[model samples]
Target: MAFPILATLVVLIALATLVPLSRRTTWLVRDLDFPRLQIAAVALAVLVAQLSLLDLRDYETVILLAITLACLAYQAWWIIPYTRVFPNEVKAAVSGDRDERLRILTANVLAPNHNAEGLLALIREHRPDIFVTLESDAWRQRHLDTLEDEYCHAMKCPLDNLYGMHVYSKLPLEDTAIQFLVEDDIPSMHAMIVLESGRKVRMHFLHPAPPSPTEHEESTERDAELLVVARSVADLDTPVVVAGDLNDVAWSTTTRLFRKISGLLDPRIGRGMFNTFHAGIPLFRWPLDHLFHSKHFTLAHIQRLPAFGSDHFPMLVELAYDRRHGATQEGLEADAEDEALADEKIAAEPVSEADVHEPQA
Candidate 1:
């Protein structure tokens, strides 16, 4: 009885670990990418159970143990880079130049959540230079509007469709545009921010649809949106920061490809996972909200803010625009194969005409 039960568990773990290795865009395959850490934990437990109960003399037991060990190793390979065991990909900031520093806060305020006051209190306390909200509707917009006096530059796109976004910035904004990259209903924001030192920094906020039974059938649209943005920034020479709820994990194949293609540095690489989603479920959380920036900027601080009636906690990051350290830090370079994969993913999902909304002066 114990052998059969353990064997079934081992096979299931092996399947979950192997299926995500494929390049399938379907939800069933891609969604498996979210729980690598959880899967690794289960594999470890199963391996221990086999060692305790299963006979080493049997070949079947040996094979099951080998499969469990392989799954553990595979999952750890993808998760270790984000742990302290690995070196930092993005260098830490050395300079204390307040003029060159920029602080950003991004949150997904779950459209149905009515605890606007809770989220508002966090913004008031943190006072981020720029703050963005996803799944913002007219009700959330009205409540957030009270902060306009402090955050003078703002862009609001309120909708009940669960993809609406609003960005409020204390810094001056230029060429701010709201664009629908893939699906017409899903919106992403692009803008140039004028730092205190008068240097210009480009910013992008994205909240692509997730691959789930309720949201999307597959991750093709989400991957396409991410890659399209990655291609846009691949050749740029200026400082860039991309943030928001990507609806994907930091270590997922699509996101890894996005980083390789865009040459953006992830602050969480050596710091921590800083899982933001499913705030209610501590054990089942992965990083869904991400902030990726150019090498021109170094991380000052990154943290996950407390939840405010939403499934996701807000992510706050302070970056110092120091070109001195930028040359020392190298972003992940995309190979020819990466380029081909990106092109293929982008081509799989055709984009519709975008509705561009510019901020009112």
Candidate 2:
């Protein structure tokens, strides 16, 4: 009875591992990508237990163990980049140039979370040049409005639909637009901020809908939005920074594709999994918020700040934009297949002028 039960569990784990590899965008399939770490840990434990206790007398037991091992390897390959084992994708700035450094702090304050004081404290301590908030409604906007005294140049889209976003920057923001790339309710902020050195770097703040019970039924819209933005910035020469609650895991196929298509570098790669979501439950947390930048930038400091009564802990990243290292940092190149998939995803949902707008200055 124990052998049969163990075999069944191994088979189930293998199936879960295989589900994420499927191209299906359904919530059931997409949600599997979020818990890759947890799944890998459980699979590893099962494999060790089977080897230690079970006798491999039968061919069935041998095949089951083989499949389990393969599943663990697959998960590890996807996760290894976020661990310390892999080489760093964004190298640290060898020269400390204050004029070239820009610190960005991004947070997704749960709409109902009223811990404004906690978040305010983090902002004061970090004192980022640019700060972003997602799921920020009119209420949260009121609290965040106090930041205007410090961040003179700002863009606000305080909607009550839970997709609202606000960007506060001490630096000068230019050509700022609030665009809805796919769904009408979902909003993304696009702007060009002139740094202290008088260099203009484009910034994109996005909070795409996640594949969940109450949110999106499939990841089609979210995937399309990211791919559209990826395609737009693939050829840009200036520094680019895309940050916010992406609503997708760092290791997901969609995000990996986005990185390749956009030619962006992930600071989290080879550093650590700065898991931001599910602050209440440590075991279930994964990195849903992200900061991906162009090859022109190098890492200075990146950290996950303490929770502030929200489901997500804020993420702060300081990047040094040096044009000299533009060619040095290698980005994931998109091949023919990656380009084709990006096109398909973008064509699935196209944005128009009606979906784009500039905030009231």
Candidate 3:
């Protein structure tokens, strides 16, 4: 009985590990990409059980062990890059002007959650130069309105839908625009932020729909939205920061493609998982809220803040715009193959400009 159960577990684990390797965008297939760490752990546990308790001398047992080992290795290949065992993709800030520093906090407020004060308390304590809230309806927006006096530069697109987004910043925000990239109801914020040092930085805050049964049937729209943004920023010469609840894990194939196309560096690499989603679930959590920046900046600090009545915990990241260190740090460059894939993704789900909203300055 134990041998049969272990063999079944090993086969299941191996299937989950291999299924995501396909280019399929269906939610059922893509969802497996989220649990690489958990899958790896289970694979290791099964391997141990087989070695100590199972009859490994049997050819069937040996094959099962081999499959489990291969699954574990495959999962580790994807999970290891986020661990300290891998090299840090974004260099730590050594020396930079204080005025050049930009602190940002992003949270997915879980539209139904009414704990606005709890989130407000976090903002007061951290006092991030910029703060973004996703799933913010009119109620959440009104409660957070008190922040406007300090966060004078603001962009709000409050809606009843779960995709609503808002960005408030102390830094001067110019040319702000709220655009719906893939879906008309889903909103993404874009703007030019003027740092205290008078340096301008292009910023994009996104909260694309996730590939889930309740949200999206397939990952096509989500992938297209992300790749569209990636291509838009790929050739930029100035500093850039793209932050929000991207609804995709940092290590997923789509996200890896996004990095390659955008030439952005993930701060979480080599630091920690900093898992921000499933805030209430200790065992089933992954980093969903992400912040990626161009090589024109280096990481000063990155932290996963405590949850405030939301499924996703907030993320705070302080970045220093120092061209000296930024020049030294290398960013991922996309090849012709990557460009072609991105073009196909964008073309799959064409975006309409009819839903774009530009607030009056």
Candidate 4:
């Protein structure tokens, strides 16, 4: 039993390494995340099994332990993105004015998560200039009314299900538009605001449903919504900021392509990775919560705020759009090819458009 279990451990360890070579293994992408945690369980089971192997010699056991140590190192590789030590290319964009600060807080109050006091408490403490909430219902809206006085500018849409979104900002909003990019009723807000110092900034708040067995079919709608926004970001002359629960990991193919195409910078690199979602357990943490900005702003600080009775941990980011005094640098990457993917027509799947035009939902 001990020898068999040792061999099984070796095989499982080897299988996990192939996650990076996902072209050959189809389920690897889906299961790679699962095995990320199970490795320790595998290690413990192997240890228990090996210890009971009477026939194994001491030297042989030592060799097995060495292999286990190597597997441990492999298990830690996923943490690279989570730790946010990405290279210069992925580093945070610099700013000319270091003193400027813009605070943003993004929270997803799980529609059923009835802990309104905790969320209200966080709002009272943070006092962020820009605030966004996901999965908001009519009840959540009522609970958030207390915030109206602080961040009086409001564009809110509350729904029964979890895709509802809202945004509140202190900056002077010029042209605020709530758009239904893919389907109707699931609205996303787009606004242009001028800072007190006359710096104009574009802000977008989105909460698109993820593609899963129950929620959405193919990723066409999600992909299209993101790509359209990416295209808009590319055309902007001034600073642009897109923050939301994209429902895709930062390292996924779509996400990398989004960053490259949008000409945006992630504050995660060189800074710490504040993994949000699954606040119930930290082991399953991923940076599903995010804040991406254009070259004009420098991220002063970013963090995943404490859980606010939701599955997704809220992300709070402080951004200042003033450029720093550095010799202007270039060589920025632009997604010239991503446009085709954005504009390409999707197979318009049959969706329940029951409330095609829901009454100001």
Distance (Å) between predicted and true CA of 196, model 3?
0.4
Instruction: State every prediction's TM-score relative to the real structure.
Output: 0.96, 0.96, 0.96, 0.76
Question: For each candidate, what is the lDDT?
Answer: 0.90, 0.87, 0.88, 0.66
Candidate 1 yields a Cα-based lDDT of 0.90
lDDT accuracy of residue 131 in candidate 1: 97
- Rank candidates, lDDT, best first: 1, 3, 2, 4
| lDDT of predicted model 4 | 0.66
Candidate 4: C-alpha RMSD after superposition:
6.1
Which digits, one per residue and each the tens of the lDDT, describe model 1 over residues 114-148?
A: 99999999999988999999999999999999999
Q: Per-residue lDDT for 1-361 in model 3, tens only?
A: 8898998898799789889988888999999999999999999999999999978689988999889999999999888988999889899998668899999999999988999999999999999999999999999999889988998889999999888888999999988888877888988998889989898889889888999999988998888888878777776787888999988988898999999998899988888899998999999999899999998898899989999999999999999987877877776778899878777777778752233332222
Worst 10 residues of 1 by lDDT: 352-361
**Candidate 2: where are CA atoms >4 Å away?**
352-361
For residue 180, model 1's alpha carbon misses the true position, in angstroms, by 1.0
Clashes of each: 0, 0, 0, 6
Off by over 4 Å in 1: 352-361
Q: After superposition, how far is residue 139 of candidate 2 from its true place, in Å?
A: 1.3
lDDT of 2: 0.87
lDDT of 1 at 265: 91
